[model samples]
Target: MHLNRRHFLGTGIAASALLTAPTVWGQAKPKVVVIGGGAGGATAARYLAKDSGGAIEVTLVEANPVYTTCFFSNLYLGGFRDFESLQHNYDKLAGGGVTVINDMATGVDRAAKTVTLAGGQVLPYDRLVLSPGIDFKDGSVPGWSLDAAEKMPHAYKAGPQTQLLKKMVEEMPEGGVFAMIAPPNPYRCPPGPYERISMIAHVLKQKNPTAKIIVADPKEKFSKQALFEEGWNKHYAGMVEWIGPDFGGGKVEVRPDAMEVVIDGEVTKVDCCNVIPGQMAGKIAALAGVTDDSGWAPVDPATMKAKADENVWVLGDSSAQGDMPKSGFSANSQAKVAAMTIRGELTGSKTFPAKYSNTCWSLIAPDDGVKVGASYEPTPEKIASVESFISETGEDAALRKATYEESLGWYAGITADMFG
Candidate 1:
């Protein structure tokens, strides 16, 4: 098979052209590439694969082979739940006919409608769904970077850092202080830091009764504040202390290795510090040219289509969801809406009306739980809320316990919806 250089080059071009060409009108199916395999991307991939009925090809790109959900991660820290309970596999997505690629997306070529994988493979797409979730804004806090996270665990995204933080808390001396610095608003899992405090307090009350937990927050008010306060008073009174934006004097600065936190012009040292910084859409979103100054992608509320790029859609915490809070439940709901819209566009059918819903649950103790939620309908410009589902501040033990149980059930159901 000795061929001239010219002939070899000609053959290569022809093969490349054939591979990139769209399948025959009725014979070839449209291809969709979904980035990220968290709640939003996984759900979108599953629905697109299943509902397309072989009419659409779905490929999902994720950096990790397995996903550990942020939902219920606090329970893991409190020793109420194990890591296995939060772990999920993408086998179901593969089984559903989606090509699950265990790789990170490097970039997106919107004009050509292609996704570049970290492995240097280019996947062409008729439509692309980006759900890369949250990325911490580097230097959002001076001296806080990925390197600093090694010493002071944010545990915000969950996984190894989360476990490390739990270990640090367990090893702290009695009466030692555990300081937590919360991020600004619009971060992933808005109620997460408060839930974390409750869970850590749960562990501390048992392991080191004299140990104190301090929250140095950037915001004046927090999600489920009254409920968390009530639970703290009932179960771990005097063990938990909150320094809101005002009381903290201002935003706190973190010193990871030294385990130091500066609040209201006062410097304090702690045994452990969990500093969660402000977050934005992942880097791939920026590379795709979909993000604005806020570091989030703006999208059409009705279709989930990117405001900047028509063929691309953004979902999850990475998307500017208008009225929707950034939570796992919101991501799951948005995924379904986006999936339906993408399918309709591919099939030449009318887009369905969009509706969104979310419920974020936080546990103050093993049995004490609280939640805030909302249901929304699409308006001409954006999604608007029509109803709310929120937990009252004061609740009986039995109701709180029931809510905790319900949170577990919701986690199971939502994970099933995403990856089962």
Candidate 2:
């Protein structure tokens, strides 16, 4: 059942009619419009469509026809994983009676409760869920823009850019410098940049021993700092160099074709560069007038309901959930809680206060992994941590290998839960 534009709209109308039936009086099927189809949005769509049992209408809008995860993308660059393994289809959501629209969302009319797409179609919704993810804070690097990203790939989003970076690395000359400009704190995947450097270093050691990897970071410390430093020392001594903010090697200013990173008032050029700029909520969140000065939507921790508008719910990277990191796992977990809250609110049932969980994994090498996780609950002043699941610095080689394997298993299970 290929749901073209016409069929999708028709199904939505039909679902609306069923809710208005006399026999089902007082029972209104809440119309849910999800603005992104990545981990968070896809999980929410599947759960709402399946759990509602036709009692709720689920419509998902995504710009891309398929999704490629940022997780494990470093392995792709290291030539350890294939691109196809990271791709996911939306068949499960469609089969479960979800109205999937493969189109970019242009705006969201919160007052009118309608979403405007790039094609000029408006989707009316009784309740809106936005998980559009993050967008780079352009100009954080003086001359860095979308155009410049083509030449100097950030590879942060894990798609075409990842391929471009891999190709560049493969073609670079021996003894060439592969520079990576790391972003500051409070960004997606806190440990991602370090993990990328580790993977790239692994390749450099194997393929081009003369090649050098440099990380120019704005922060003094990072995720799994001690672990990553220990691995670098034990494995690739003197092959990788990290310049912290104090070393004057981390400030970045973008040029038209290159990035100018100032370190101690001196500049060093590179053969290829990966500059990960700062990030904020996606465009759709801004369109809905839910974002504030921080460029992220604020939501009530207890309900995941937008503080700007009651009918709207924001989760994932786009929403400012107190103290929660912008991670896929956190987003997926929050979506489940959001779904339950929405269902209870519409059905006049008891609503439970929302709780969120997050676990982030970073691989130091092909068979070495480290993780940090926490669970949170709402408090009178803010959301507070309830428990921690932090992995220790030292572990047996077999344990690290098992963790790496488990990470892959987790990816498969989460992807299946979202898109089947």
- Residues 1-420 of candidate 1 have per-residue lDDT tens digits of 223533664575666567755343333467899999998999999999998887898999998898999888998999999988888989988998999999989988888677888887888788999999999988776557889987888898879999999999999998999988788888988888888888999899999999998888878887777777888898898988888776862457777777788887788989998878889998899999999999999999887888999899999999986888888899899999999999998977566778899999888887787888999887777778889977887767898889889988998899999996
Candidate 1 stretches with Cα past 4 Å from truth are 1-27
Which residue pairs in candidate 2 collide?
248-263
The worst-scoring run of ten residues by lDDT in candidate 1 lies at 1-10
lDDT of 2 at 37: 91
TM-score of the candidate numbered 2? 0.92
TM-score to native of every candidate shown: 0.93, 0.92
lDDT of 2 at 327: 84
**In lDDT terms, which candidate is top?**
1
Scored by TM-score, the top model is: 1
Q: Each model's C-alpha lDDT?
A: 0.86, 0.82
lDDT of 2 by residue, 1-420 (tens): 223644776675677677755445433356889989987888888888887787788999998888898877888887778998888878778989899999999988777688889888888788899998989897776557778877788898989999999988887789888888788767888888888888888888888889988887888899878889877886688988999988755566645354445455667667778889888998889988999999988888887788899888888888887777788888888888888877776655566667788888778877888788899987665556799876677787898888888888888888888886
Each model's RMSD to truth, in Å?
Answer: 3.8, 3.8
